[model samples]
Target: MKDINYSEVNGYLFPNLKGREEVKVNSYFAQMKLKYLKTNEQGHLFSLMAKNELSTYLEQVEKEANEMYERLVEEFKVKWNVTEKLKERDQMEWVQQMNNIDNVVKEIILKELICN
Candidate 1:
């Protein structure tokens, strides 16, 4: 199998918005979306078919949202780093941190998308 580097991913990387700030904002929005969706679905806000149809639609949305969220976070990791210095080799650490942040965002998006 061929190995794929981070830079090879589809889409342009963000030159800025590295570290915790970006992650935090994304996470917050994802959570909000999840909460809203859950409430709406539970309350039968759609007023369409039965619960089965509503649940199916919600599942599809959640799946797409999760995929997008994961891609965005991976891109962020590749673009942002603590330092470019070769000797220091801290960029990898930054990448790891970014991955952690991505997890939080993914969870929020999953929940929100399902609910909403």
Candidate 2:
């Protein structure tokens, strides 16, 4: 185990750990996954923490999920005929269709990437 230095602040001692802010993830998918892990996947979460890999793993998850999201959006757009032509043909209909696609894609991401 590595040494943990401490500093006195406000009549309390806190471990002086560097780069702790990296654990504060920004991606919505990543944050959801972290919460899920904390509540339902403690063993895996502990394993990552033991190796000091939680931040790195979450970052990777965010990147992969984002990439998958973009790819899936393109595929769904093609499958649903949500093209520029549709947008030009019927603006209201296109907007509705895109809103539906966005909701469905978010659900897919939550199930496949964030939760699982």
Candidate 3:
């Protein structure tokens, strides 16, 4: 019996299968055949299908990774802006405290000079 290539069979059955869906189906059948079929012809066909599937999967992963990196960059920018605002608030508080201390010291000096 001639070994059957299920990926080719599927392509014939789903002539309209295109894009990721087609790749996914091909990959799934290729994996199933690799697991269950022992014939040389089926093995070769399945191997080819698997290679195409892997290429498609890698492309999808790369696209997702780029999107995730962009999201992380935006998040980092928001966090940095918040951190800068907090630092500014802290500096303002420190200056206010210094001015209060200076006023208290001036009052003390004036009191002493007037008394003496």
Candidate 4:
């Protein structure tokens, strides 16, 4: 028997098989389809699925981020007795603080939701 190169097989197959249980189960047919399917068609299908999944995830993140930002702003307002009639420097400081907090929250969200 010939020595099978696991790395080669993984490099060739993983992209096609990743997140696809049916293809993993029917690997022989999957290999056949890879031969028959045009490369552009396969790429297009992968791109479409990726875009759909990413958009759905982004929508959820946007909703969550918006809610969190609103809550944070409300809390800050109540905690600091902030009003719409604040002085210019105070308003700028508040905006800067909110932006800093937002950056931290966004990092956490991306790490938790997208990197995991």
Stretches of candidate 2 above 4 Å error? Answer: 1-22
lDDT accuracy of residue 70 in candidate 1 = 69
Q: After superposition, how far is residue 16 of candidate 2 from its true place, in Å?
A: 13
Error of 4 at 69 (Å): 0.5
Task: Give TM per candidate.
Answer: 0.40, 0.75, 0.30, 0.36
Alpha carbon lDDT of each predicted model: 0.52, 0.88, 0.44, 0.49
lDDT string, candidate 4, 15-105, tens digits: 3333432322123222333333334355644663454453343345456655665676667666665556553548787676666656665
- Which number leads on TM-score? 2
Tens-digit per-residue lDDT, 48-92, candidate 2: 876678989999999988898899889999999899998999999
Model 2 TM-score is 0.75
Sorted on TM-score, best first, the list reads: 2, 1, 4, 3
Ranking by lDDT: 2, 1, 4, 3
Candidate 3 per-residue lDDT, tens place, 1-116, comes to: 84433444645643333344254423322343333333435555455555456445434444544454455544544544434555577977655554554455434433342112
Pairs clashing within candidate 1: 34-112, 37-115, 37-116, 38-115
lDDT of 2: 0.88
Question: Candidate 3 regions off by >4 Å?
Answer: 1-51, 82-116
- State how far residue 106 of model 1 sits from its true place (Å): 4.6
lDDT of 1 by residue, 1-116 (tens): 84434442368643332233121213444445435645765455334233235444445554578687867676655665424462266667766676676876666665555444
Best by lDDT: 2
lDDT of model 1 at position 68: 71
